[model samples]
Target: MAGITGIGSGIDIDSIVKASVAAERAPKDAQLARLTTKTTTQITSLGSFKSALSEFQTAADGLNDASLFGTRKASSSDATRLTASAEKTALTGTYRVEVEQLASASKIASGSLTGDSNLAFASGGKLTIGLGADSFDVDVAAGATLKEVRDAINTQLNEKGISANIISDPANGTSQLVLSSNKTGAGNDLTLAASGADLQGLVTNRPAALSEAQNAKFKIDGLSLESATNAVSGAIEGVTFTLVKAEEGVSTTLTVGENTTAVKDSLKKFVDAYNKLITTTNSLTSFTKVGESGEPLTGALLGDSTVRNVLNGLRSELSNTAAGQGGDPFRALADLGITTQKDGKLAIDDTKLTAALEDNFDAVGSFITGDNGLMNRLSDRVDGYVKSGGVLEQRISGLQKTDADIKEQKADLETRVAAIQARLYSQYNAMDSLIGQLTRTSDSLGSALSNLPGVVRERS
Candidate 1:
């Protein structure tokens, strides 16, 4: 057999064809990828929605309410409402009045002291003493012991007010409890002349009853608002702005925001995305390549007029006029410098667009933000495509599976072809070697005939 071997067999035309077919199904590989389109739309819608909410929030954060969380501290100036008993309700407003009795106005201490020169009990520990008509007990220290006995006497001592306190006694090493009352108002005025240890300078002076003031003040969006009492409500509709702290000035600078650059950038993005979608869609339309063999997308979606109609509608849809509460706010995308062309695509004029935002921000907001906005619509379409049975998701999945299958089959076919090539080369080498041996054998036979030439020459 010849030593020569086969090279590639024939060109693997089947491999090429199979590869092409698999590639043709490549779009199906993107089915799942397409499903995420809805998520993108969802994110867009959520952003727009949040933007809308921020607008209202800005208008609702100005008023202040004091009574709800804070309390006006009580002072000595609180108005006095005389009570016949301790169950008396608190008085309203501030005042300066002398109290006849702390616990009751009806029950007044009567009679005068006899044995002891002063009205103070023994020292300031625990004293069991007898009063006008009833025996009483008193304990005096500094503050609590001072008010505790007074409270007990005011509520129980003939229902009259009783006040007492212990004075620091340097002589006895123990504090003395001083007890006194203005049982005879304007006359007794309550006197405390401690006996061997009387409250000489302590019980002589006293403070008059007082009341505190209660009122609230606040503003909304820089407008002065008032509350009848400390508790305020209905200052602003839809949202109540509480004035936590009273503002001294009227013209408060509300530093909202002036970042039109980002908004302008968003406009450009919308335009760019719109055009890209249109261009992609157009490639599938009657727009054909000059010498291409086939149209990549030549069916209802690609070449169909109906498809163009839908696309043309999108120009209107994206730039659709939106009405605002203030009138023609979202009248047209051009209003926001988002202009539509005859080619059914949109473009943004960055400078003019940003200027428009400064002049009238509500219009731009109405288009992409409010009820039935472009973001919401686009998101809905995207959402539909991303779910389990969506078109893009299914198409991408199909393409991917198809590409995978083709790749697998191509690998298998290459292996089998390599095996076949090895076998064919083996057979071709055998035939080439047999041809070489036959040629050598014929040459040896011719040489033997040449040696018998001398006998023929003698006969001649």
Candidate 2:
């Protein structure tokens, strides 16, 4: 096939074979190309739709929580003195908080030592450190330096809430072993006991208290409260306030109120996500002019009933009243100023929406997050189409099978084309051989006639 195919026949046999094969392959190849393009387009369209649907569902689900509606905002009059945060259970009120004392951790330092001093402990020595009820023991080997003792205590007893460090004074050029408790509060102090002479000198016997362990003392609404740490919670229900600094008689006022801004922002996000989904679905199901030739181009999902059903279902759910809006005036999304536009997207009336949320927040929330609420209904419907083994997945799976079938057909057609080419080459070669034989016969007869003796005598 690679060499000169028509050399023996003096004919363009290669061109003939190519022409025959092309004629047979043209229709089948075109069909496969069209099918391939269609399947790929469908897959891409479905994937885009599913992605947009997923985002929309997530936004809707955020608003589906009841606690979000009851969100509370906490503010401190003097944040420098205190900082506060409130949960959904926190009631709206003002409280006077006075910080009596900020908690301090227990810190102890050992006697000074020379810089190059290499001190060793007695053999089989053990250092036992305790913090409240928790205790841990560190094994001390003979000839262990101050650094070694610090490292062993840190690496071995870290889980027991103890830290060890060797602090060096630059002016004196002396280092001492300092031990501190990881926790704060009265009774949560570090108590060290050692069996070796060196270990006892470092932790047990010769120790100076750098800072005393103390509890956080503060007053909440004229009621005194004490905590192990500055971060005090449960002193007031659903509220946690951190005591930054204590100024006697300087009280900070903390106010807890409804967080309407968060609710409004959440609603806006849901609207934006829903609009995006609508836009995506519209484009995928629309028709438009394709190119300069002015041919009409249909969308990949045009005339798809699955797309139509999903859109219709969502629209219906959005228009209906929520389940738990028994006597509330705002039962449907439309009541809260969310209405359907002519282009199938949702538009919000800011004035009405704001008034609805500000005037009757609880009622509005009930309408949207109730059992049969718009978000609940929409969430369920979208899940049916986008979830695994759902409508969109099934459609994509079918298109993939079509792709496989197209490949098989293409391979079979190629085999047929090759066989046809072989047949054409054989026929042309036989015809060329017959023509050569006839030409040879004619030359031989003409030579014999010219050599005849009678013809030569006549010419003289």
Candidate 3:
């Protein structure tokens, strides 16, 4: 309508309306843009801070374990024969082991058969599978083929760890149904019994043991020990040996010792992670220096008390001395050569730390992983911030809500501005119509005056 509004009035109504609308929109647009930028920056900064906290927590977790300081390194002279692993409780010593036999699962093959094409198993007949003193019966449905009966047993009694399979023995030019036990032990022998003639001939009186169930026979330091499985435990305190195969005459030496390198590596990771968090917090909370022609730039979280509190809390926890250690032997991170730098970052003296760990390994473990240790305290603090309803989480949630509010405000502004534009157009159209009517009225009066002969009428 504004496009045709200025035609009668000889004034550009469209331009006037556009200018008015733009003036009305400028302030709100600028305000919304500023708010959006601030909210987005806060979200990104909080995300970085949270990620740094999580990473530092992970590093702290690595050192939180007492066993990390007492980690045992296990090695087998011949890995092909056997492999070993040791835990923190493992003693540092050398052990000679010889594996005589590997524990085997019990397997039985039925007498030679032409094929598993069909079987005349009697209806409602039952097959009993025995493992040690435990046994379960599988019902043989009427007119079940050998394959169908195998499937029924597998589907029904599979919970008992019994598996049935039809294996083709080309070497013997015959096919046989095989049943095996899932467990490995001499006591876990597989025995089968069938009540029906069809099943009895096929499963009962299992032809000469295909492979007898045997226990893993091995000797540790010349002391004979038997295990139900290849993985033998309790032979050595906190150490488990896995027997690969029998090496009758060969003996493998297994040595267990403290893994000092691993401990030092974990400590260094903790230090590095702590320093990273310090750097991130500094950036988030600190301000940039004034430029040559502008004022100083504030950080995303500048003037935020939460940021300051978090940093201060972490520093306090890190600097505190752990309790439960009677003496100052290794009670603080400083004693382990992890000192606080002037910039609030942790700096590790590798040589001093290594010497400290080597000299008092157990005391160091007790100090860092004790009930009131640095890691435990710090972990608890960080958990509060990142866990449900924590300070940081709540802050982020509030910021998001503010963002949502801003979005709604912008939408409302757009609606109001559109309505204003429509009103301006309507006003201009009414003004144009009034001006056109006035012009026509003046022309009619001039014509009437000219027709009275007092005024001359010009020729067209």
Model 2: CA > 4 A from native: 2-4, 7-9, 67-80, 85-89, 112-144, 152-157, 169-175, 189-208, 257-269, 290-293, 321-326, 337-344, 347-361, 456-460
Model 3: clashing residue pairs? none
Q: Tens digits of per-residue lDDT for model 1 on 43-88? A: 3433332233232222111101111111122222222221111101
Sort the candidates on TM-score, descending order. Answer: 2, 3, 1
Candidate 2 or 1, higher lDDT? 2
Q: Return the candidate ranking by lDDT, descending.
A: 2, 3, 1
10 residues in a row with least lDDT, candidate 1? 60-69
lDDT leader: 2
Instruction: Give the better candidate number (1 or 3) by lDDT.
Output: 3
Q: Compose the digit string of candidate 3's lDDT tens values, residues 1-460.
A: 4456776688789989999999999999999999999998998899889889889888887788976876787889989998988887898899999998899988887765655446455554778888778898888887887788789879987888889898776665566778888788888888888787666666644588677788999888888888999998888999988999797867999998777778888888898888899889888888777878788888898888877777788887766764545765876688888899898888888888889876887777777775577788888878887767887788899999999999999999999999999999999988888898898899999878878955766779
Q: lDDT value for candidate 3?
A: 0.82
Mind sharing the TM-score for model 1? 0.35
lDDT at 156, model 2: 82
TM-score of 2: 0.82
TM-score, one value per model:
0.35, 0.82, 0.70
